[model samples]
Target: MSTGLGRGAGRRFGSGWISGVLAVTCGALGYGGVLCLLFPSWLTTPSARALYPLELVRFLIYVMLVLGFGLGALSVVLRRRKVLGFTGIALATAGTLLGGSSAEIGTLGGTTAVGLDWFLLNLFILALLFVPLERVIPRLPEQAIFRPGWTTDLMHFAMSHLLVQVTVVLTMLPAGVLFRWATQPWLQDAVAAQPLALQFLEIVLVADFTQYWVHRAFHRVPWLWRLHAIHHSSETMDWLAGSRLHLLDIVVTRGLSFVPLYVLGFAPPAVYAYLVFVSFLAVFIHANVRFDLGPLDWLLATPRFHHWHHAANPVDKNFAVHLPWIDRLFGTAYLPAGRWPEVYGISGSPVPQGYWRQLAWPFLR
Candidate 1:
């Protein structure tokens, strides 16, 4: 209810900034939802399509559109930047005009597609979860959601999500061929005989062990570092920063990480559980929230622990993704009690400015 002006470069927070942001987010997602309905094969993800109920999705889209328009109106009345509200309002209105949730389905099938649905779904979920978390328990209170290079990070996020199909294929192809002979039926049964919980733990250990070396290789190998540097290039560490990884980096690391799991014949369910856990863990370590885990910080990697790895000069401290023990064993662990990095990113800032530029940067050099 406070309509007071905000400080720090005259940015207005109380005067409808929150409403405008929410409106734009909801409006954009709602518009995308309509497009998915109209072209499910080309725009929607198979995982979401198979799992989500159509009626429920339509209802959600309808709700988002209504809220986007209504909140945009409210933001327009209370904010100086009418563009924010108008943009939100326009998106919602356009979705509605294009038939919104009632958009007719095309005859085209799912023979070919990208992950637009995945991007929208993930963006909504990640933002919904992390935005409030950072605001409430922030490592840097002064840090704004839309910080410098945020747009670049966001573009990276969108591109990665949209290419989920490609990444998945590339990751699994070599893995399947290399590990097929080793996926013996008896071995699979023996591995699967273990309790699901135990299997998941093994998956975590295997994944972390494999990723440790792969991650280290990225830093040590100059050519690989060129690609991996795009991830380190993010000057500001946040949840989105983790999503700034180069596509080749994602594919190669993931491909090798899967090698151990696939060769060992872990149950698919356990593998899935580890995948979900790693997804969250990756984002959590890069987040703007810091936790004092006491001695437990040595047992697992935390934001403070990982942030030091992103420090300006020596950006090769922590190498383990989950277990910091790997780093300690390898002599790369660096953690000063109750301290975070004062600065992040590379010293000379060799990485380019834009997403497209950075995509080609590693190759150019």
Candidate 2:
């Protein structure tokens, strides 16, 4: 199958597609942001909400509501395809009528709600960062922003993020219980006592080592491949495509990776810094950008390094996420010197398209 959008992925770029995209993205996410503010205790992640500046968030929502409506109007006037324009306008109008940024906050509750806050913030921030980069230095210039399977990948991103609380709980439950006995206070104190920079490096190294094996196992094991095939099913690669993973894949791999970090007990700040860094790195590797990192590509993971991992021809290789050297050490690295893969996705045993279909796929097959 062609990796291109094929037909009816949406209108051409020169048309109002760009404006419509910005309008709908801003409107929908802004609406979610306002709901997060209004129901901080119920709609937000406690750990994440504490980090956000309420006033700044409120201001951004107000600005986005106006921007969405204005851009939507511009699109409506400029193009015949009024669907995107109309959708943006409706979302913005509804958000404004629902008190815009100043939505009322009632009594707070202890119960954890859906992570609307995480979803909106991550989607907004990552889209803003990667979209422009991809357009500016696209690996495949003809690769449109909205590819054939984009909406499906987008739904995967949305659901994975929206259920952050549940995923986090599940990830931590196994790691914490299985490795609880391994937390040596003396060792934790020593680990924490190390310089913050050193601690951060150690965390990445430890986590990467664990995930490297877990990642390889997914590719090697037959039953596991059934679940992992959904990820490889994407015929295209992009920042968004990385989000197209089986929910169980996320939990198991990340949960196992967390074991080392939790047991060693790195300092919270260092750990938090690692979390921020890893999140960006994960998306960066999957991005559809042409970034020639030169020698650093060998020392660290890069888009080329990762894109090879998803190559259609190279069934199982380049298993490490952060460190390419890990793959080199294990003789599983397949990054052909200075060459990009001709195609992506698996060869046989095709995984079906669409979010719900892919979700139910592993079991049925």
User: Per-residue lDDT tens digits of candidate 1, residues 5-99?
Assistant: 44311346657777888889999999998888888789877766778787888888998899889999988888877877888899999999999
lDDT of each: 0.87, 0.87
**Which regions of candidate 1 fall more than 4 Å away from where they truly are?**
1-10
Instruction: Rate residue 364 of model 2 by lDDT.
Output: 93
lDDT of 2: 0.87
Clashes of each: 0, 0
Q: Model 1, poorest ten-residue lDDT window?
A: 1-10
lDDT at position 125, candidate 2: 91
In candidate 2, residue 204 scores what lDDT?
89
What local lDDT does model 2 show for residue 218?
94
lDDT for model 1: 0.87
